[model samples]
Target: MCRLFSLTSRDPVSPMLAINALNVMKEGHDGSGVGLCLRGLGGPFGEMKEAPILSGIFTEAGLKRLSQVSADIGLDPKYSMTFTPKTPPPPGTPKRGTYLARAFDIPDAWKGLAPEELAREYTRFRLMLRTTGEEQGDMQVFSFWPDTLMVKEVGDPMEVAAYLGLDNKDLVARQILAQGRQNTNYAINLYACHPFFIQGVCSMTNGENTAFIPIREYLASRGVDGYCGYQSDSEVFAHILHYTVNRLGLDLEYYKHVITPLTNEELDGHPDRENLVRLKQACRKLVIDGPNCVIGCLPDGSMFMCQDRKKLRPGVVGGKPGVFAFSSEICGLNAAIPDRDTSKDFQPMHLDTAIVRPDCQEVTICSQLQALPHLH
Candidate 1:
């Protein structure tokens, strides 16, 4: 088991707001590591929102290779901010690594393309750097997208936050996703931590994915790029969301349908049953099998939370419209939004998908396979 916390607000807020809440559920996680992704960025990143921000850890030798590769690719880094942790790492913990955040201009060829197309290219570019940098040395790439930054390290959530200067820095964002991983069945790997991102879609989960193999095969077959690393079974959720909205050109609600399709008996009554039947047949490989809760954000900045059909995982989605919070427990939401109506905070039903955005409102996109109460 692990813990996941994410919040989206109209105004830029510190990621510590989410990480602090995640720490409340420390008991559920062994403090193996913390992974975070921030969008709708502000603070030092506020002014550089238009250019893609490259984030990752690099060795001195790896840095030199990065420079050469950037020149070779023709996407020169325009500005960079490197953070060296001031807080000493805890005993038995690995030393803090050199993390770089660089901004680069979109290639001239992609200048007037659709955002989805351009975002795809940005994802591909980041993958190239990750592949190339890995051959150079101890280099790891997280994300490269406009108005986004990601930080991950192996340690306690609070300690990792402090090591990264998350509180002291001028960094802020309207949306942040953080995870405290509890390794099960596999060795501890930083890349396997949650809050995985592909292109503009980012996700963090609280449970495992039994259906990972088929989903991974489906994604790899897409042949669009950025789907190779399966360090974590949960990474497929982000790729599924990416495929649903970005590749399939479907709404976020459809993502819930693809991953948790209803049985034929239930779908027989659905208004969109005909189309859903085709969708289910076409995307059967994506139907996840396991108790899971997913909190994710789209390239457009809209945030969503959904549960698997079994609803085995614990999760709650609540808060005002513009400042929604999704977490594995109420304690987390309490830490971030204590004043909000706890009574109003409700756990999403098995078929319900909650959506929030910069606008102050919450919307539920439920499965059409089931009928609303008192409908007849």
Candidate 2:
């Protein structure tokens, strides 16, 4: 399915490291792209971004039409705000459109059901999009890659197709990353994240759950220690996580938390499959005392210019530039952190900086993953 995944180990990858990786994959998939905005800009928590083309997606004319149609059912002023859709750019325009509800602040009951939530929100977003998602045309939100990893160095399309065993490159647009293994048996086409269009009723893609509810149930029942979620940006992620944790009455220091990918099936449902309750339980015990984790992820190369803009200072790896990258690569990192040049020849950084990072950043999802080879 959606192939993005991260591997964490106290000896290697930690929770902070996982968050950084997840941040890289999700840096670009923000509320601005979706046309959502929060009322208050400076709340303690992160504010939502207004989708770039809010006015265009929901036009005055379209709102009028919706009003008239809704008047028949008294769904007027009560939901008038729902009528004003974010505007959509006309055809042939570089800028695409956003969903109307995305920009509007409404009850979770009023928004689109987010089916894509888990380790690889990006990959799941693509997968859900392909199954039942839709977005602004300009954004090409549904264009998944034949292989997400091949994007590491910007290789030719043909080269990517060759590595992913893609017979019909034309059929795939969004990136879908997966590692090449000698005995790979993963059912790679079952990604739960997919593009979705919001409607009056909150719904999700490919018959998945409304939001990450299914994933939550999966994790809670399995006793996993990590949390899986999606937002417009890292700040929004921070906000949501901050609020949710407070709601649960748990402080940030209860233990180390590792975020990771829950399989696509887990996001929606693994029909005919048993839950991974025991594995999740083990995860909780491990993280309740520690915060290390392996988060699922994929790099958004589009931010090649804004790499380190959101990276936390006093980085986890000290001065290893790309270790806690905002985006995926150093060139991408260069865009975010213009001061540091990863290209500079050996500036005397940690040896791990040169960890032969592969194009497919996907590593052993964790030896722990192997422990539950049959999690489903």
Candidate 3:
């Protein structure tokens, strides 16, 4: 089952534009979104989609297509797009992406635009839809968000993707499964908002994404378990993985989690107990300075919920705290962060990459998908 969740906070440093997104997971994400900040205005607002593969989210139609085409159909897992940015991004980073499409640019000098303006505009103009999970109370759905994120597979290098709404991709997983080694090796893909990329801008035809995958044989060997539900890319699967790694510390194998360096003065002066900004910086550092195929640990050891510094600046005043929820798409997570979905409470989440040693010759990342209470 897939769940939706997000965090909203208030701070003095950032504007109202949608900030960090959840790190992408192995199950992949469909619906997700972020708020726009233009200041001085508040109302439900939305933007026109530039791609048909990413448009027409009027109601259940688009969402339904997402489940069918992206998840069920098992669309071919492939990658062909490579971006040569007009300018180099931050530096050595993989958590960011090329600007595939412009989601409406804002002037860097807009002090009038508050964060709430973006939240209000999205709520007022956009139609809210979530992915309903069969999992009992509270874990009912993941808010739908249109996304076209692409990831580069270093292991095999396939362009992995996730989408919300109908797209006739029922054969997606099956297509992936078909390519598998006799179904014994199951392929797992993930999507969230934790990006450490160093190039590309937020422009039209430059939407960003992160992709990852692990084989089924490895998961089964570790006694890790998961169920592939319709349109369920492995949201629950991710949650389960989190439990194994963070709570169980299974990552000690070939992968190691190191607490980043922090200053006493900066740490002492900050008020947001979570210190999300520092956490994201560390995750980005993982991709930049760590090893090949780095693992960027998120705010919460388990889920990739809220946006992090790898993607954008820290967030608003008490928007939401905790590493319980993360979104594949900013809008999807934001839409569900404050609403009711059976029983799950929406919240922000953390992120991390499961860096495996090329010499290990095995897979070993344990985690799970989370729930939401969204509707913001």
TM-score comparison, 1 vs 3, better candidate: 1
Model 3 TM-score relative to the real fold? 0.21
Q: Which ten residues in a row have the lowest lDDT in candidate 2?
A: 199-208
Q: For each candidate in turn, give its C-alpha RMSD to the true structure in angstroms.
A: 3.1, 16.9, 20.6
Q: Which of candidates 1 and 2 reaches a greater TM-score?
A: 1
Residues 1-376 of candidate 1: C-alpha lDDT, one tens digit per residue: 8899999888899889988997898887788788889898887778878889989898887788778877777776777778678778854357745888888876678888897788778878888778776676567899888888888888888887777787855778888999986455466666687789988789988887888988898899888778887888998999999888877878777888889988898887687777788888999989998889999999888888889988989999888756889899999999998878777887887888887855847755565454432211
* Candidates, ranked, TM-score: 1, 2, 3
Predicted structure with the largest lDDT when compared to the true one: 1
Distance from true position, residue 301, model 2, in Å? 22
lDDT computed for candidate 1: 0.82
Which pairs of residues collide in candidate 1? 321-360, 321-361, 322-360
RMSD of 2: 16.9
**How far off is residue 13 in model 1, in Å?**
0.6
TM-score of candidate 1 versus the correct structure, residues matched by position: 0.93
**Between candidates 1 and 2, which one is better according to lDDT?**
1
Residue-wise C-alpha lDDT for candidate 3, range 62-110, written one tens digit per residue: 4344345434323222222223333322222223322121122222332
lDDT of all the models against the reference?
0.82, 0.23, 0.23
